[model samples]
Target: MKGLLKSLLVLALLITSMSVAAERVHLGFTVHYTLKSSAFSAKLDRVVVTKVNQNSPAMRAGLFPGDVIELLNGSVVAGASARKLDAEMGAIRAGDTVKMTVLRSGKKVAISMVAGET
Candidate 1:
C-alpha cells in the first residue's frame, strides 16, 4: 500500500508538471486586424489592430485596441494575415523579446515585450 501511494504521488506530480510546461508554450495574447488597401498607394496594404488581450504581452508592452501593428521584429507586416502572424508568433519562444512598430492614433510607436505563457 505504501509503495502504491508513492507511485501515484509521483505520477500526479509528473502530470502537473507536464501541464504547466505545455501552458507555458503560448505567448498569452490575442489580436484582431482588418486588411485595407491604401488610398494613396494602390498596392499598399495595412493591418489595423482591433483588440489587445488583457494581461497579455501586448498589453504589457503598451499596445491597446485601435493600435496598428506595422512591423514585427523589424519586419513589415503590412499584408500579413492572421495565420501569418500566428506563424511569426509561434516561432518565438517564451522569454524572448518581441519588438513591434505600431501606429496609434496616427502616431508611430515602438514597443518591446518579453513573451510569457498564457
Candidate 2:
C-alpha cells in the first residue's frame, strides 16, 4: 500500500539522520536543559574558556567561557542548546538568585548567584 511505503521511507530517513545528530553532539562539549517555552531562546553548550572579560559579570560570578552549564534549575542539559541565559535574564533581575548547575572537572555541582547584567 502507498501508506505503508511512505511509512517505510520516513523510518529510513529517521535512522540515517540520527548519525548527524550524534556528530553534532561530539563537536562540542556542552550540557544544556531548557524548560518548556516557545517565546524564549538560547544556545547552551560546553564552552572552552579562552577569555573572560575584565570586570564583567562573568568574572564577578567566578564563571568563564569554558564553564559548561550542565543544568538549569534541576534538569539535565543534554540536548537542544538554548543557553541564551544572558538574554533571558532580564525577567530574573538583579539581586535575585539564578539557580544553575555546571559540569566542572568532571564533577556535577549546583550553584546559585545573584543575577546581574553582563
Candidate 3:
C-alpha cells in the first residue's frame, strides 16, 4: 500500500510537469549551432545561422543565414549549447524584444527583434 501511494504521487508530479512544459511559447525561429561536445555541456564552438523564415521576426529584423550569434539579451552565448539557447528563447513570449549580438564577416553587429509565434 505504501509503494502504491508513492507511485501515484510520482505519477501526479510527472503529469503536472508535462502540462507546464506544454504551455511554453514558440520563439518563431530556428537556431543551429556546432557543439564540440554534448548538448548537456555549455561548449558550443560556433553558432551558425542556418535559416530565417520569411516574414518571421528574425527575418524582419534583418537576421540572415551565415551570421554567427554571439550574445542573447546581453548574455554571452559563446559556450552555450543549442538546448540552452532554445530554452532561453522558449521562455520568452510573443511581442517580447530579444536583443542579440552577432558576427558577420568579422564584424560585430547588434540587433533587437520582437518574438513572435511560429
Candidate 4:
C-alpha cells in the first residue's frame, strides 16, 4: 500500500511537470501580437545587409543585407539570429522556393526567394 501511494505521487508529479514545462509564446514590443487563444510570437528587428554573396540566390532574388526580415514564415521575427533564421527562411537551398516579408525604406515588401550560401 505504501509503495502504491509513492508510485501515485511520483506519477502525479511527472504529469504536472510535463504540462508546466511547455513554453508559451509571448510578444513584447518589436511588433507586438496578442490574441484570445494561446499563441506564439517572434519579435522583429531591423538588420543591415553587410554584403551579398556572389552569384547566390539572394542576389538572384534581389535581396540585400540592409533589408530587414520583419516576418518569417508568418511569424514575427523577434530575437531571431541570422544562423537560426535560415530554418525559418524555409531551409531554402539553391533552386528551392522561399518567401519573406520585410520592411525596407519604411515600406512592407514581400519577396519570393530561393536559399543560397551566405
Candidate 5:
C-alpha cells in the first residue's frame, strides 16, 4: 500500500509539473521605437512595426512594416515606455488574444492575433 501511494504521488507531481509549464508566445514581428528628443527628456513618439515575418502571426493578422502602433490590448501605446511594452509582451502566453490599433497611411486600423507557441 505504501509503494502504491508513493507511485501515485509521483504521478501526481509529474502531472502537476507538466500542467504548470507555460508555453511562451511568438508574435513573429519586430518593432522599433520612434522617439521625440528634447534637451531634457526623450519621449516615446510611437511604436512602429519594423518587420513582419512571413507566415507569422503578425503577418497573418495584417500587420505591416511602417505601421505605427497606437494601442495594445485596448491601452494607449503612446505614453508607454519601451521596458513596459517589453514586459507586457513577455507576459503574453500562448493562446492569449492580442489586439492592436495601428496607423497605416494616416488611417487607424485594428489588428487581432492569437498568441502562438514560441
Candidate 6:
C-alpha cells in the first residue's frame, strides 16, 4: 500500500513535468549529454549544443554548435540529473530572461536571451 502510494506520487510528478516540458518556451536550440572522462573523478556528463536555429534568440546570443553548456539560468548544469534539467529548462516562459554559460574555444562565455514562443 505504501509502495503503491509512492509510485502514484512519482507518476503524478512525472506527468506534471512532462506537461511543462511540452509547453515550454522555445529556445531554438538543442542539446545532448556527452560523456567526458576525467582523470581523478569518474565519467562526467557534459551538455553539448548540437544545433541553433537561424535568427533565434540563441543564435542572436551567439550560442553555437560544439559549445559545452556550463550553466543555465545561473544554475550549474554539470551534475544535474536529466529530469531536473528538463524541469528547470521547461520552467522557462516567454519573455523570461534565460542566462547561460558555455565553454567555447576553451573559454567560458556568458549569454542571456529572452525565451520565445514555441
Off by over 4 Å in 5: 1-22, 37-42
lDDT of 1 by residue, 22-64 (tens): 4544433444433443553222155555456677776778977
Candidate 4 — which pairs collide?
42-78, 43-77, 43-78, 49-65, 49-66
List of clashing residue pairs for candidate 3 = none
Clashing pairs in 5: none
lDDT scores of the candidates, listed in order: 0.58, 0.41, 0.62, 0.44, 0.69, 0.68
Q: Residues 1-118, candidate 6: write the lDDT tens digits.
A: 4553454345324322233434646677776564443564323278788778888888888999988989888888786655566667667777788899999999999989887765
Please give the lDDT score at residue 66 for candidate 5: 92
Comparing candidate 3 with candidate 6, which one achieves the higher TM-score? 6
Best by TM-score: 5
Candidate 4 on 43-68: residue-level lDDT in tens?
A: 22443343455565546667665666
After superposition, candidate 3 runs with Cα above 4 Å error: 1-28, 38-42
| TM-score ranking from best candidate downward | 5, 6, 3, 1, 4, 2
Cα deviation of 24, candidate 3, in Å:
7.1
Better of 3 and 4 by lDDT: 3
lDDT for residue 42 in candidate 6, whole number 0-100: 27
Off by over 4 Å in 2: 1-51, 80-90
Ranking by lDDT: 5, 6, 3, 1, 4, 2
CA error at residue 80 for candidate 1, angstroms: 4.2
RMSD of each: 14.8, 14.7, 10.4, 16.1, 14.9, 8.2
Model 2, span 13-101: residue lDDT tens: 32112133213111111222223434553333342333445554445556545456665555545443333332233234444565567
Candidate 1 CA-lDDT value: 0.58
TM-score of every prediction relative to native: 0.62, 0.43, 0.69, 0.47, 0.74, 0.72
Model 5 quality (TM-score): 0.74
